[model samples]
Target: MLNNWVDQLNNTRAAAAPFGEANPKMLTAFRGLNAAQGSNGALDAKTRELIAIAVAVTTRCDGCIASHASAARQAGATEAEVSDALGTAIALNAGAAYVYSLRAMEAFGQMGK
Candidate 1:
């Protein structure tokens, strides 16, 4: 395993407690945002969790990955589904890099002029 996700989740929550205490308003707002996502009922929990996992991977957020991975499992997402989501993340990252590479080439050509 890449990480002890369960332990990481526990450790993350422990570490966040003080920060949340210090910024109660921010924490509450964040919680409210999360609640709002579910309130729409447009997507089921499993789909939301899968999307969260993909976003976490794309954003390179370990804490979010751990949290959403567990939630995905709880929401009955299969391993294959998670793998497919990861593949999407990989493609997106590569596509972003490709686009940035084009920008870099453009900047390099501009520098020559």
Candidate 2:
């Protein structure tokens, strides 16, 4: 029963996060693209998983992050790699959010009370 409930909830999440709703073709294409990327010989398994983690972090996607991080660990991403990916995400996020926030601050200054 517990497993069934978990499966249902996971299905719900997948349905909710469909690619371009009402477009089954696009969703199919998205799945194909992911499969190709995940299994391509050009990039090792570890590299692909790291990329997934980065995507998860960038989108602040808890579900994706949890899923990808678990896969990553299973596929041999060491603790170091996980930590490094997180650090890289944090650094990049700080810069990204900072650039926008800094501009907003400057704009606010221009608005003069």
Best by lDDT: 1
Residue-level lDDT of model 1, residues 1-113, one tens digit each, is 77999998899889878989899999989888987887878989999999999999999899999999999999999999999998999999999999999999999999999
Model 1 whole-model lDDT (C-alpha atoms): 0.93
Candidate 2, residues 1-113: lDDT per residue as tens digits? 32343454476467755555788788779778877774649878887788788878888776677667777887899989987888888889899999999999999999996
The number of residue pairs in model 2 that clash at the backbone is 0
- Cα RMSD of predicted structure 1: 1.1
Model 1 misplaced stretches (Cα beyond 4 Å): none
Give candidate 2's error at residue 51 in angstroms.
2.5
Let me know the TM-score candidate 1 reaches against the reference structure. Answer: 0.93
Off by over 4 Å in 2: 1-23, 38-40, 109-113
What residue pairs are clashing in model 2?
Answer: none
